[model samples]
Target: MNKLTAVAVSVLLLSAAPAQAQSIPGWKAYRAQQTGQQAAPAANAGQAPAAPPQATDPQPAALPQPAYQTAAAPYATRPAPKPAPNGGLFVGVQGGSGWVYEDVDQRAVAVSAGYRWQAGDYSQVGIELGAGRLDETTWRDYGIPEVKFNTIGANARFNFGNSPWFGVARLGYWHARSRDGWDRKVTADGAYGSLGVGVDLGRHFNLQLMYTGYTYAVDSYYGDDEYDINRADTVTLGAEVRF
Candidate 1:
């Protein structure tokens, strides 16, 4: 019986020994596992660590803008105006007081025709031919012998200035005939000068006032005796029409 007890005790101890040993940690195996864990980091040390992802704000999209360009305009030109005709011909008439050879009692009238050209911007040069008659008293106190003396003349006129109004000057020659130079007379000539102002009533009409003087000569038939008639003065009001 003692022998049986000793054998049972040995068998129980043997079974418990394995269980206790396995429950407790082993130093060699634990150290070897720790070394393997430590060595894993060292093995990967040659490779770089990846950087952490960065947070970013979203950007707004850009809008399209309008573009501008400059271009120059084309140059333009205009035409000039034509000038008015300057070669128009005209005709006229004049009347009022006139005297012969210092005689204040002579009364006269005239008709004229003319041609002119524009000489410059505001001036004209022209020729005028005229014919007329004057009533003259040779011897008033001696029962008054009266005669209408026939006269003819020509003039060169200058018109100057540039408005509705203008100034005029004239130089001329005149011839006179006495119905009776004491009884029948011969033909003779006279000299004259004139000055005046005029207004243009419209594109084709004119009005004027003038002062003029003349030196007249005449002859009688018997010896065809010649004599001079002096200081013939005149004041004239005139009008003209143009084409």
Candidate 2:
């Protein structure tokens, strides 16, 4: 009986040794790790899930475009008097009617050419040469059949503020020749002066109203008496072009 009791006690001690190992610090954790490895799926197990395909370094995004552009737009209409050329060569013409020393109504036409330099922000100074013809005139009741005048002069022009309107003045030496109905010709030389106002068009053309006066002293003797034709006054509409 003693031997049998000793055998039974040894078998109960071996069984209790395993139960006490489960109460040890890491025995239950070790068993659960072994069971989870055996229960995992065959295809994805222990391969770290292929590292989630490594994310391929993610493609960069494209930059966005600007909202506004810098190109200029087309105009609906063109502007006038667009800041005329500062200095250049010019040509001009004039036509009108006038009186010769208050005695004759004469028709007249003239032309001029000059070179101008800019004198200020809105002004110019220049010299011009001009020639004109007069018709249907009576000189001191002499019934002159023809007359002609020529001049060499300097001129100044001014624009009013910012407008297209402008004023001009000129003065110079003048020479005149007249022929009577009897074909008797007399020549005189003196000074001429002119004043004018005008509008500038498209920076290159001008239209104006002008008044000019020519005063001449003649050194001619008619029947042993000396005669002088004082002056001729003319009003003209004029046009000019500049380059």
Candidate 3:
């Protein structure tokens, strides 16, 4: 029996020896390594994975601007006006009747030619030459005939505004050389003044009616040899044109 116990103890010792060798630092080091690996994974559990590499945004390039240009300025000026012509000349004719009252009644018919010079818009000056025949019947001088005379004058006129109407005044000298029934041929020289109104038909035509007064001095007569003066009146109508 003792021998059998010894064999069993030997076997036991051999197994205990193997366990002691592994119990040295080597066994502890292997256990710690395994525990650390398990704890590391557990501690990192809540941590997020590294974010995927971030993509960088690209910046936009600047655009080019348009260049500025200035505009030109405007200028002002007035246009010239047309010029006007100078003086105008005109010629015309006139005809009318007259009366000389004395102890007898004498009637006359007159015809005249005239020229006018325009001084301005409102004034004019002119001259005229005329002649006429007169019929006289006094004391029933049975076979009496007609008498005739020559006349000449100068006149001035003024227009009112630009209308067709005008006021006129004239002074003139006239001579009448009697050509009929008087015993001694008589000659008369006279001063005459007149007043009238006129119408301008256009730049080319015009008409006027006037009353004239004449004062005359006679050279020879049927009765008086001295200087004897008499008054006479007349009405005239005229037409004229510009050249």
Candidate 4:
């Protein structure tokens, strides 16, 4: 019976030795890991909660800009327009009636030549020379002779805006030579004036109606006045050509 008891005690000692060795190192590591995990939770609880991610508004995309171009300037300057020709030589002819005293009238004819140049956009200035003849007339009981006249003058013309019509004026010196009845010669000298209106017929031709006036003096055989002075006036229709 003593041998049996000893054998049982040895078996129990052997089993308890393995259990004690494992607990010495492995059990301590496991206990420390559990203590660290529990302390981390307690430390975080003392601080404020972390802020959630802030919501940011989305920005719009930028648009592309357009490029602009400037206009180019002209390289050359333009020239001015030229003016029309406003100077020329001219010739004219006229025929109409003449008057001397009361109820005394006769046929008359004339020719003229001149040169004109521009004075303004609406006017021209010139000089003219002319000659004319008046047919014979009977004065009361005395038979008067034919008359002839020569003239030199200054002349002016005016245009009515842009129309084809114009006005003319002339003032001049005149001389008259003729023969009276009974083979007697007569002579006179005086000033003459003329005015007319005209229209252009083409580039170089024109037509006009004109009136001219002058006075002549003749010695009288029976009269209170020193000389017999008579007015000689004519109305003529004329045409002219210009160069």
Candidate 5:
């Protein structure tokens, strides 16, 4: 009986030692699992989801502008003009009547032609020819008669610049033929001169007032004549034109 009890106690102690060893191994395994779980979470938190692949091409930057550029130009301007000069050629006509005091008082018609050359700014020289008829007349109670005369002359003119007026001196020669109702013919040669002043109207027309003088010689059946000079003075008012 005593041997049997000692054996039973040894068996019981052996069984308890095995159980404690088994428990230690199980506790170590549980702790390792918990530590592994904590480490996993920390690693996950630290590693950012692999940074989304960084872009290769970056966005473009803005460019700058230039400060010194050229501007446009401005406009231009202009000028003025001048004037003309004066002086040229001229021509025209004249008509009027005159008288011879004491010797013969007559009415006549005359046609004349002439040319003038300018001698200065206000002066001219010219020559003229004219002819006319005379009415019934007698000289010195000699029963002489009526005659017609032909005249030729030259003249010089002077003009006043401030006015349209001029002064003239004329020298001329004349020839006359007479008819006395007798069976004879008579003729005379003479010289004459005139002094005058005239006013010009526009466009080559002028009005004139003049004093005329005549000296003559006669040839007839009356006899050989000496100093057959006849003297006459007259006034003429006429108009003239220019070409």
Candidate 6:
């Protein structure tokens, strides 16, 4: 009986020892789980890795343009003036000295208006009307009368070239009358011609330098005996305006 009880107790103790060991965690099993290799998911385990995305050509972007450009032209050219269907109207002013040929020197100022039609590749034909004053004319043709003069004229002009630098020619008829300050009245009728050059300031403005010569027949001055002919010349600087 004693031997059987001891055997039974031994078996119970041995079974309890296994249960306690299972309840306690082992350090070696913990370390193995931390350091061990992991398995891949079952779904992708057999497939080859996806090939890297195939490269495609990139699109081009617009190139930058230069800010400056080169000119192939050797010379500068003038721009054409505006012309109307009927004709173009223009106005001008001139101021300079006028001398009665073989007589006295005088200061002069003139204003003019004109109409022009294009006549050629680079020239314009025009009719002009103008009026002006001369400051003094000390001598009559016979050197007897002291006078200042007023002048009125109708003219024809030819402007050559569409360039900034250009040439001009004019022919005109003039009438001159002595001003009231003079002691006696005098009158002269004449024809005049001029040659000039001009620069274009811009589209509507121009500057000019001119030389003009006049020849007159004295209709009468105080009395007919004073003179039969009168002559004068002037150099003028002026401006022309067009619309």
Among the numbered candidates, top lDDT falls to 4
Q: Tens digit of lDDT per residue, candidate 5, span 8-52?
A: 999999999877875797877887899999999898996767677
Q: List runs of model 2 lying over 4 Å from the truth.
A: 1-85, 101-103, 137-142, 220-229
Clashing pairs in 1: none
Q: How many residue pairs clash in all the candidates, one count each?
A: 0, 0, 0, 0, 7, 0
Candidate with top TM-score is: 4
Which pairs clash (backbone N, Cα, C closer than 3 Å) in model 5? Answer: 90-243, 91-241, 91-242, 91-243, 92-241, 92-242, 93-241
> Candidate 2's residue-wise lDDT over 55-132, tens digit each?
578678966654333333444345554455456888999999877746467888999989889887789899999999
Candidate 4 vs candidate 6: the lDDT winner is: 4
Lowest summed-lDDT stretch of 10 residues in model 3?
78-87
Cα RMSD of predicted structure 6: 8.7
Q: TM-scores across all candidates?
A: 0.54, 0.60, 0.53, 0.61, 0.53, 0.54
What is candidate 6's lDDT per residue for 179-206, written digit by digit as tens? 3444567677778888888887876788
lDDT of 1 by residue, 131-223 (tens): 766665544553222333333343333444345677767777877665444555545566777888888888798998888877766443445
Residue range 139-208, candidate 4, lDDT tens digits: 7777767889999999888878767788989999989998866667889888899999999887699999
Clashing pairs in 4: none
Query: lDDT score of model 4?
Result: 0.85
Worst 10 residues of 6 by lDDT: 142-151
Q: Which segments of model 3 are wrong by more than 4 Å?
A: 1-89, 102-107, 136-145, 179-183, 219-225
Between candidates 1 and 4, the one scoring higher on TM-score is: 4
**Cα distance off (Å), candidate 1, residue 225:** 8.5
Better of 3 and 6 by TM-score: 6
